[model samples]
Target: MSFDDDPGRGGGDPADDRFSTLGGTRQTRTRLPESTGDPYGSTRRPQRGSRSLVMVVGVVVLLVAAIAFANRGSDSGSSPDGQSPKKPDAQSTAASGTKPVGGKQGGIASGYAHDEQGAQSAASNYAVVLGSEGMFKSSTRADIVRATHDPAVVDGLLSRLDQAYTPSFFKNVGLNDDGSTPSGLTFVSRTVPVGTKVAQQDGASATVEAWCTGLVGLAGPGSTKPVTQTWFTITEKLKWVGGDWKITSSSQTQGPTPVSGDDRASTADEIAKAVQGYGGFTYAR
Candidate 1:
């Protein structure tokens, strides 16, 4: 079933009709008829008044244009020799200049640089771990929480999450009471960060937002809860602890979701195989 059709998984309408552009009304201009015979019955004197007005308007427009051009040139960072520097392409998906971290902790990327970019990377990776299928299982969920959260919050976060992913919750998503998938079915829960933004940062702390897309549910021929896609933004409050970024607190809101696409849904076998074949990335932006 489509995500929207599943009452258990609440989501907004896929039709993006919330916003619309208002049509502008056209303005009509009435032109005065030229005096064919000089209504005053005297010489028009070449309409010097109108001619002077036009000249004044033209000069004003030219002066404004010249000023604008001068300002633009100054702001464009042109060299002293009057040539502009080559700009990097806006559409380029180039790797960042920061070096990748060399280590992992508890199977998750760790040892991030202690900078804004590092905090962003940490937040994104944490989002992925928190949104994974492992979070549904008690044992792995404890490991994930301990690895991703600050030491002070790990116990409390683990306790809360354990309570949240209850037996009924597991069954609702086609998982067993122990969060295991039924035989012959594949349970899929994965989050891929599309981008990261540092909302706030200081010497020891940062607030980062990870815009993510995820797949969750069961993938199999007879599965009632087939894998469905979701979009969400995960905001993490991170602190530089133990020489690396760690989550102090985190929250998720539904989405800055895109409209649903027209692509046909893949079969359960194809989806299961693809998930098994393609590994997720270790985001570092």
Candidate 2:
């Protein structure tokens, strides 16, 4: 079964809204009133003072135009060709300046630094593990729970998760009662984090959100459940424990989804081979 097909599973990805600025100068043109038959039909000559005033006004207009030209030329953000640089979006997939944590526990990234970036990193990696195929099995699920969750909530979370992935649940998803796939079928469940954000943080705690995409299902010839992709956001409340970040609680919500494209689905064998050839990542902020 696909991850999103299960009612208990949560899904989503972050959506970004972009905005642009527009600017223009309004010009007011003044014109002298046309002569109305030149009172008494007499031709009039311009006075010297009137001519001098017109010269002054013309000079002022030229000075203002020059200043406007100089200001535009001095805009550092514009290129030599006069186009403004395209600003980067607020959210990006680029790597953060902070270095990733150097330690690992139970094969998962651990020992994050004590900062908001650290919390974001921890949340991303935890989201991957929590949404992985291992969560469907008893032994590996326990290991994952213990590795990612705070010690205080470990037991309770384990019990709840164990009940959630019952034998009936396994059977419904094309897996055996013990959570094993049938012969010649490969069960796939993987989550890749797109980006992370620290929603709120303090010296000892943080609330982080992880936007992710995942693939889940049974892949093989004649498989009833074909591999499918899903997007989701995971919100994790973390606490500083044992000198590292640990999940105190977590929840998931369905997507800021993108429009689907028209593409052909690959054969089950191809999907199975791709899953085997690809390796998962240890995410960082």
Candidate 3:
């Protein structure tokens, strides 16, 4: 089951064709075939059975440990029936040893600083903020791009982002022509990550996935736009730049989301009006 605190409002997957493109956990730097796909017919071999047994036992142990850790909290993961609420699918990712950044103060967990989880967490949070409502306004954009993006990418990305946040895009998101709100309308575009993982990790870098759900739109009197949700993946190229793990580049993509439910839908006017009245939050894993 999907678990969004708001229980309302959403987006089709959006992507940034910038310095680096984003991808999901499935979008790994390398593709590995299942054990059943023994390209050389090695599956028939039995000489290495002893070694294989050791490996299998080790794997079982690790899986048990991981499940225990993840389930440590009442709010973590899903229940036995597999229907616990989670963050967006895009927020957790990894590529082997590499992990997403966990916190800003943790510094660059990249370059294999021995903190893969922290790195993945950092990347996920950065992606959420970069793809947030702040991206629409010039001032907020500057702050977000500066804070979340690497300096090397800031200048060029800012220019391109400005171009992308065109007047039409603003209108599409239920904002005014200038990307402002109507007197009473509240425009919302918020992304909250459910969890993060390192799909593939290396000493220097790891592919991180931030499985996320978002709310975007406007709410106010006479407004037609309503809040909606979406799922997507955000792939990032993280570098241990400066003293921290800065995002050298990133990109987005559509889900991997589930089919919509038959829940009663909210009216457009109500959605629009509600958007104007409610404020968004800073989501976490």
Best by TM-score: 1
lDDT string, candidate 3, 1-285, tens digits: 222221121232222322221121122122234476667764432223334656899999999998987767645467667896655664323234433333443221223244566566576667667667777889788877777667888999989888988989887777878988778666777786755656666665566777777787765566677677889877777766665656777777888798999999787667766655765443322
TM-score of 2: 0.69
Give the per-residue lDDT digits (tens) of candidate 1, residues 171-231. 8999999888899999999999988888899999999988999999898889999999999
lDDT of 1 at 151: 99
> What tens digits encode model 2's per-residue C-alpha lDDT throughout 1-285?
443443222343111112211111112222345567787665445323334656899999999999999997778878778998787785456677787787999898999989988898899889988888999988799999999999999999998887899889998888989899899999999988888878899999999988888898999998988899999888999999999999999889988677888998999999999999999887777
State, as a TM-score between 0 and 1, how close model 1 is to the true structure. Answer: 0.70
TM-score of each: 0.70, 0.69, 0.56
Between which residue pairs do clashes occur in model 1? none
Candidate 3 ranges beyond 4 A from true positions: 1-114, 266-285
Q: After superposition, how far is residue 172 of candidate 1 from its true place, in Å?
A: 1.4
For residue 221, give model 2's deviation from the true position in Å: 0.5
Off by over 4 Å in 2: 1-93
Candidate 2 minimal-lDDT segment of 10 residues: 17-26
Preferred candidate (lDDT higher): 1 or 3? 1
Off by over 4 Å in 1: 1-81, 85-94
lDDT of 2 at 108: 88
| Model 2 score (lDDT) | 0.82
Each candidate: RMSD: 14.8, 18.2, 22.4
